[model samples]
Target: MTDQAVFPRLASLAGRLVTARGWKRLGLAALAGALATLSLPPLHALPLLWVAFPALVWLLRGSDRPKTDFTIGLAFAIGHHVPGLYWISAALFTDIGRFWFMLPASLLGLPAVLGLFLGVGTVAYGWARRRWGLTGWVEAAGLALAWVAVEYARGHMFTGFPWNLIGYGWVPVLPVLQTVSVIGIYGLSLLTVLAAALPATLVATKPSWRPALAGLLGLALLAGWGGWRMAGQGLGDVPDVRLRIVQPNIPQALKWKEEAKINNLRRLIDMSGAEGWDRVTHVIWPETAVPYFLSSDSDNPDQAPLTRLLTQIAPPGGALITGANRLATNEAGDYIYFNSLFALTQGGTVVASFDKAHLVPFGEYLPLRGLLPKGVKAVAAAADFSAGPGPRAVSLPGAPAASPLICYEVIFPGAVMPREGERPHWLLNLTNDAWYGQTAGPHQHFAITAVRAVEEGVPLVRAANTGISGVIDAYGRVRGALPLGDSGNLDISLPQRAETVPLYADYGDAVPVVIWLALLLGIAAFRPRPT
Candidate 1:
């Protein structure tokens, strides 16, 4: 046989093998992303998610083009988000059909959008490879830096949905999570991306064994540093006041109904009574725990029962805080309903109230109402609820001044408490998670609360309507919790004030911003050669 003919046959066989391997890599990447999703709350397989990312980086390194890398990343995102956000569809089963369509859109849309960040990172990695013929340590560092930039963009763009950050997967790994006190969640996310991309450096390039060894050593060093920090940082002293968190477990279908109003108030009052409020310093009810408008209807009929229960449970020193719909008549003669938290003394006298400022788009208020059909407007609330003005911090008599965050507000990183010198001592997050049912919604929601506690260096006392009611210390430790899907009261001690503020609380994700700028400059500096 001629040498040319033999060479062609050998080349064809090699090409087929390479194609098969590429498909395998893509499959592995998808599997890894899906596995990582399970590590989040409601599953608690956190270690599994960490392993998945490195596996994904390894799989993607086999592909040379930007488009191929994007496809693999997209597949992984779909797998990760479909199960991770399945609870979003639970709202669809309610009265609104529009919610069903919107649920899928948001569930798929968010991940799809976030996956673009990964695509950008991978494209940059491929570009760097071709530009400098970089491999091993150089490739790994560049790709890690590129991914950090992507995470930063996802956090800041389009009102910024920073849920399920790679660092959050490290929640179960306490020592690593403690690092948040210094760098905040963004820094941890950068570290996570770096760690996950380390294995890719070894697999993708031909380099001396020393470079691979260095990459391995770097990961070990991070883990070791985290473990040391965890050991050194002990739980600070417990607070003087005892907090009681109440989870009503009310169904969303009947929550706002006129008929259910009386029964719901009675149920909450009964639960509070059972806790023996005399012993507890503060009693908390989940968001919108009261179905009726507390400020409207002088003859509510149910008020007598609620007042009686409060008088019975609330001792002279104790105070009661409950979630209710408060109505205020504006200058326009329209009755504005606010999802508010009201504090009351033993005699049912209103102490102070905080109206929710950060309302959920489409859920609490619809955007672009003028353009919508009249029929759609009729089906929705009369109009969007107006945003409350200023920070609502109320002195709880004997306890610390508490800053209230209703529902989705808890998810926003630094937005929970007042800025700088005006910061509150503790965070009170009241939410009704019943809308999302038993899916990952409640778990993910709870996770955000924990992160908030760590970020602000404030203990969070959270009350959820359906389940996952608990008390989280300053360091994101769940000191006490009620199981999901259960109706119960959790009595726990809040952590005392930490003299020092967390870096995140003071700086507010500044590190991620800097990283994003650096990555942009890096990309602009290096131009890709024409194919």
Candidate 2:
């Protein structure tokens, strides 16, 4: 009844799992991958990953040919991404009448394209293992490394959709989530895949339970280190910095209606200037809250209404930082439209502003418009949005210098901070999550936003039109908040930045890349010759 003796029996069962062929193997692979999606946000069922990854490892063992391995990996990845990203289709439902044709494309087509990275990555790394009849820890390490490699590439390649990384599974556990401040997300994902997959070693020819024990030890060490880092921390608040985040919970369909535009602004003003209006020093609004162009400072017929609204919403000495559209003539006399964050001080004086540097593809601008069939248009906006130069830290009246991230721009980890100037005191994210209302998209988006605060060692303040608005201190703790689909405003004191910048902020993804290379080297050194 010893550990070594029991595990060989597991090897026999694993052999049966490996013998699955054709339709049976494909179904099991897809099922395992689909189960893994539950490990993502709003669910965060970490134990499912234990089941999913080990099953994938055993399934990968069934095939020796590259074609067979690639297909298995493809089916597995397709299953994983479709469920994890199913919320994407909720945006189409905002105007379902026009976009009904895109349902299958959203649910199946997108995942099919994105999943190729994982499929190819598996074939590349798993090749050596099958060739040498590798087993035990070495084989598990190979699988773990391949998963992280694909995760990294999917995040960086082709506009890069890096949603639901394995690391985010730790978000529900604060102590575990703190690990991102050190190794960054990719490194966290590397350890996550490694720990989760190591149990598969129990099914190796010379099976031993020690590998599973080691995996548990890895989790314990990670938790111990994270617990220590967060141990005596308080929600360090800054002086004279109070913020009001207004969430009107407007529907995406009504947000841009010409008739409802004035009413929308009034709703924002009402929530912003509600009960505790006198005590608030600054007000924040979600992306595209105004819906109409708020004219520049110079005398124009449209300027009067903007000034009146600013007087109603702007704090006495502070400013109102809200999302708006900016139309300006370039040096060549061509008009450029930008999705932007503009700060209006008391008396309607325009102070500081930052245009969104990273624009969302398809949502902001189509990649190759000439290639697409005629009459097709970008889904999110009526006109294509121009990109800003890059990240900028602009000074506000009563708040610290802030870097503005509009909508999906906040999702990118290393790119949120200013590139050249002094580091901003805080991050200001304005988003309208109404596009994917009442779904996991907003919750997942908010989760990713919190991680950036920890990774950059700065407090983050978020305002969303349809909720998940909050103030996150430097440690990623939610100090103040509102839920999805809520109509309200939260009055919160701006939390102080962490005393020291995080290592990941200074080094970026290089921390994880180094760890990946080390794992690759170790796996190669320990490889057994082909049997």
Candidate 3:
């Protein structure tokens, strides 16, 4: 059999296999979703998405009603997100004595909520296809567009959790991931959905090769361009700055305890001022490294102890940037508390500070504060954390000006860079990954942090309370790192930033927006003529 002859026959067979109804359809949908999650980080089995996305397209095609399509999509999403986000339950385990009962709820509840977006998107796909009588490549394009629309919405709605997006599946493949430098992650996600879903075009009634072949060609072009961009490029020259990332691997349970506070502070101190500090210019501690308020507070006797410890470890003529909590009195005469990044000079004075502008909902502050009970608190801290003005790049002695991202703040694309000032030379991310334990959370978090470097054409220096602490150069390569769940310090030179700002950095979401609009137009312009 020739090449053209075999594909149609295979597609016809796939159509027959995927057209089952009732429990069989639901089961297949769920299986496809579970398989798709294997493609994400820590697994990166990307080939599985070939089977999963086509299965989703086939399921959507067979549905006669929007409700049925929605049900199938919901089943798929639940399978995908539950396994993908099961690591979230690890956070609840830190204080198992208090939160043990919430384990199953955390695992099952969050996925169900997130799946609603996919469900609604599928419903829209069904409506568009049925209303316009779409088929073959047009149907595939429509479904892919709808799927990405939902993904984008989920990424922006209600504090926005964009974890495990399909684009991250390409992370293990450097040439493929380089696309983000031009179009950002969401643009790559759009292409991923389109390519994966196009296989279903072969199974459509028309059985046209145009869409599937086009998708393959597009992917090839992407890889070719990326290969050209990265060809012959090695880690650029190291800058004048050198850093010591302190990963004490402090347990979340012990991080805030009064009795253990001194030990935690001492651990960071000893690790920073360790034997190798004589040449290091800057030292970093993870998010909330200092449990007590370190800013000047005459009324609080803890200030003296805090200053005494920091005085010993502060680098000569350099600064120590660490995560801490700060307090300020507003004109209303009320105290506002913030999760912040403070830069302490050798004299023990905090010369510069960047308060975290984007606060984590529920983790830092309750969303519906009035609705909750009086004494209830957020997960991370006892009191609610107030949001700061916005992003700021702080200048240190020897290091280039740096933008500070605290904890989950680094995860947001197109939102991490400072809004007004000159672009920072490097991104300084301080996070406490200890809350999530040794599960996939830290690994996934580190993966997202790596993407930011490529998107901005700048280096990223990430310090985590547990591990995955490292320096990633502009190309998203890990120059050096401390292993997850280990206590150690990495002494490394900062890699130089890419010479030019990335296309995505300059244009923001415009790339993805243009792609989405073009796909939508194709669906409309190519509607099938009367048979």
Candidate 4:
């Protein structure tokens, strides 16, 4: 299994790439990063990771110092994240009149901030590799550990934005995708990076082939176990809880217009009450679907009619769950707003409500509004939204207990669980992707949201404005979905939550952290490679 025996030419070419300097080193690194992005959602070119990652290994390899490592990783990550997340700026275009200037910041600024995590992670990896003189498969393992650690950091740092975890590349590879049920996304990411980087060993040395072989063996075991898990296909349905998700496809520009408010509300009602409403035990709407003030005590004069207007689609004993802008006066006597979910009975009573806790940094509320430019306020923060108590679940008359995740709130791992009393039967994610329009942002968002079901071992029903509304069962299967920009109501029986909780559900990210530490310890055992 010497380099000459199998990958002599690959080894030779990589040796050359590994010695690249100056702009060429960074250019190749950027290229490798961009190539890896093809594995992301909307285009699942997964095997490209094999090519991209090893090249990245060499790119990091060519750089010798910790400072050099930081720049390389930052370049690589910015290349990866910018293109992968370019669609994020599409939101600004939705309100070009106001958000016209924020476009560049959304496109480049956000990714730069996120990419810093990778830069820092690489610094750690570089220090470890140099400190231990790590090589071959152990070197690959070292890189994978750093990658996953930073990914975990990215998801949690600063209210967290866990978009496009590398594990998501397996979206098209469902059998392998099942691995997330045990390891969670971060764990899946660890294995994915390990496996993908193994090919890099081809050019390194003789023993590297063993690790490469081991990686293949690992994938086989994972895929086979996943296949067995999938074979038990008779995932039962939650009895009596027929659900309907409505996607009104309201245009973002007119969604908040005074003239179009009634029409938008009427459209959602009509669609929900369309032909199949009779069999639906519960109805769902996307984030802020009820763009009007809903509570009777709210300042808006039309609050009473708004509540009764929502009941038109509610079943006799069932409830209609919709996202609304909740109004309240904080203890300081200042008017505060909350992006919240409200459940209403057929009698028009507001039964339960959950405020979104993990608000988007500049989207739901500005971080420091007073210090910014005179009129520089967040798009949704006409009045900054006050943070909620925490994750919560609600028990309505007709549906099983459900935890509602508003918009990007569903992206956080383990945090989706209800803190109330018991684990809920399902996850309800209400998102308004209308801001992103018909773009990869929503598609990626939907894929990311669907995977949460597997992590939590529960059914996830997502209602989205402007599309991607559907049902994801416990196994992460998209049982039903409405495409982006489609205006319709999807009716389906609610899939039952898995009888057993997933390892990820029980351990959250602890499962992945153990894997990372075990590998680090293994690499530590190998004496410094005679540096």
Candidate 5:
């Protein structure tokens, strides 16, 4: 045979193999999305997480078109978000039917929106692979960097919804969770994406044995070290302060009715009275525990009953912190009502109050109110409440001062802290999960609260109406909790003051931002020229 003929035959075989590999890559990407979604709540099938990243890398290999890669990535993100966030539909199940459509709308819409970030990352990855030509370990670095950059954008883009970051999957592993004390959740998320993508490099290219072995070893070492740290760290021996958290479990339908206001107060006082409040130093009630505005004119008739009940439970130094709607006339002559946390002296006097700063969109207040339909506006009570200038820390007379978070405010990172030189002893989150019903929404919301405790290195006392009320320690450990659909009071001990601020508390998410910036710059510098 002629030498030229042999060369052409060899080239043809190589082209066929590459074509087959491309098909394999697309299949793998879809599988990865499905697997990753299983690791999220309602399923929490954990082992699937280990294979998710490897599958993504296999699926994207050798794809020349950036748009194709983006579509594949978007598919994976939709799989992960749709099933995981299905509980958002619970809002529609409430007494109001106006938002019935918003449930499925958000389920599909949120993923569609968030998938854009992954799409951007996939495009950048393809661009980097083409320009760099898989040389000098650059392809592996590019893929890892691209994924992390996408996650960063997911954490910050459009006011940021940092939920379901890959790092959160490690919550079940204590050692891995300890890493948050140094790097924060986003930093850990970056690390997690890189580790998961490392195995893909081996399958994509025939690199030196040394680089491949090193990559695998590095991931093992990181996970091992996290395990070690988790084992060595103690829960700490801080003095435990006795606490009583009340979950009135008030139904959402009756919460705001003028007639039901007195009934609601009686239920809370009766539930709390059963606890024999004498021994507890701090008593917490869930958000909107008081149906009527404490400062409103209609309180004249209800005041007598509330005062009598509060005075009856008046224990010498014990303080009661409960959620109430506070009405006040602003300087502009307009009446302003606030979702507030009021510290009451057993004698029924309002000693201190912290108004909620972060308001839920559509829930607390409708955006572009003038544009909404009349029917929609009528059902939304959140419109009546005005946002308080934020970061309010309530100080009880003799006890430790605490930073109070009302309802949805607990989910925002760094937004929960008091001003400099005013850090509180711990975080108190008062929430009403009744609207979520028996769905995973309450559990998911509570998980974020746990992360916040770890992020800030402060014990979290979460009081929820209709479930998941509990005490989470600095390490994200839930001690005593009342499950969903249960109406009860949890009496536990709060950890003493946390002196050190967690890395997240100090530097915020700056590390993740720097990582994302570096990845974008690297991708731009290495993007391939058009053939």
Candidate 6:
């Protein structure tokens, strides 16, 4: 064939691929989802979503039945999550002797379950497209709304696991991420899906670049506004308070062992008392730094041995914040456990405490516990940990008032703020990333923590076991950090809060709600002329 003929042929083949049916269409969607996964943390190639989302839109457009569309979405999610969450299996290897049986389930089962949300969203998108007789940009808009809705639902459904929302793609690019402060992460996500899928309109039967151009313009504005904010926003340092975050690099396998408890506690004390101990006002420790059950003696108000130790490490007038397991009894007489953070004074007094409200489904407690045999244990806890009252601002002496986020609680976007009263000046996130090894999990967790800081317009102080601990300014800039698998203390002054509260922090998810309504109204107003 001549050069001109060959070029046209390739274009024709590309068109056919977009309109393919059955397994071929499903394969394309799967491929697109896999590509989209690359845009997530550890390999933050966010531009890949431009190709991936367009492919998804094409698959959604070509599917004639809701069942087929559901499968297409499921395939996409499987492709997206299998690789996206592969690091989840890292926790299993920590106890290979017992958890070896769960390796396959750990690797594939989670994605399979989480993909159901995507499948439902696709089914809705297919129904809406067919019901409205929608096409082109209108169809793209509808799909974007549905996709964002599902992502939001995924973040909230069944205790919520919004690990790698589409908005997180912009995490590595700090300027683009500043938009989250205005609209929150879900709002950014709505725009992300729309911008990514808008390219599909260019390939439609009646190809028009107008929608694609609009998407590009929106993206340019996002970048420009973020750059302006970064330039103009005057983020200052809060006076008087200072921080000393200790990353003990404790191994997960031995953390709960009886023999290692004393040594582990000693390690945290040693790290906290390093060279700068006398100067710091707050000494922070990772989640569950004390391996023993802290609440076992909760009934009494007297000082526990752990409290005595913290007093020794903290300066004369300083406070210590650390994580531990607390126990309590329910009305039924069964003992319930909690992952908690305690702020202790140098005189061995418990000044304040915040129990973790959001628990990792399998890691902290098994879901559908009644269905599982009693012998089946959770990955991290032998007994299920009960949920506490949600996020609250815990007051520490000499230090600024702050909200406490134990372990995975920091992953939730708008949900991280205190339930009532004035917003805290900073966020204290205590986590143990040791379970997932030194893999993508910790990196992804750290990125999510940074986004929370920007969204709330508050500085974030993260202390992690075996990892990625750092002091992030309100603008998502890392002032100081101890890298993953490193045992050390990061001494830094606290970053000041923005003088004005960010729009998202004031009105959480209100922007996304407005976008959802707009999409619905567009679908209702859209009228196709009779043939």
Who is ahead in lDDT, 3 or 4?
Answer: 4
Q: What tens-digit string does per-residue lDDT give for candidate 4 at 340-440?
A: 89888776678888888888877877887777888677876676787887777778777788888999988898899964478898999999898887678
Whole-model lDDT per candidate: 0.69, 0.84, 0.83, 0.84, 0.69, 0.84
Task: List the candidates ranked by lDDT, beginning with the highest.
Answer: 2, 4, 6, 3, 5, 1
**Candidate 1 ranges with C-alpha deviation above 4 Å:** 1-29, 44-51, 58-66, 96-98, 116-129, 132-134, 207-240, 295-313, 370-373, 377-382, 390-392, 514-531
Location of the lowest summed lDDT over 10 successive residues in candidate 3: 1-10
Residue 117 alpha-carbon offset, candidate 3, angstroms? 0.8
Question: What's each prediction's TM-score?
Answer: 0.83, 0.96, 0.94, 0.96, 0.84, 0.94
Candidate 2 stretches with Cα past 4 Å from truth are 1-13, 295-301, 529-531
Better model by TM-score: candidate 2 vs candidate 5:
2
> What TM-score should be assigned to candidate 5?
0.84
Weakest 10 consecutive residues of candidate 4 by summed lDDT: 293-302
Model 6 Cα lDDT, one tens digit per residue, 1-531: 111112354346446655688888777877889999999888899889888887787777667898988999999999999888999999988888988988888788889888899999999989988877776678788878888888889888888888899888888788889999988889888888888887776665566678878998998899998998889666777787788999999898889888988898888888888787888888899998877666534335543665776677766676888898887789999888999988777767777888889888888888999999778988988888889989888778887789999888988888988858967889999999999887888999998988999999899999999999998988888888988999888989999987778888988888668877887787677734448
- When summed lDDT is taken over every stretch of 10 residues in candidate 6, the lowest stretch is 1-10
What's the lDDT for residue 476 in model 6?
88
Local error of candidate 3 at residue 290 (angstroms): 1.3
**What C-alpha lDDT, on a 0 to 100 scale, does residue 417 get in candidate 1?**
82
lDDT of 2 by residue, 1-531 (tens): 212324566666667668889988888888888888888888889899888888888888878788878878888888888888888998888888887888898889988887788889779866877666567788888998989989888888887888888888888787777888988888888888888888887766666679888988988988898888888878568888889899899999899888999899888888888888889899999998988775455245577667666656899988888898888888999988889888887776778777887888777888898898887767887778888877778888887898889988888878898767688999999998998878888988998888889889899999999989999988889998999998898999999898888999898998888899998898878877654
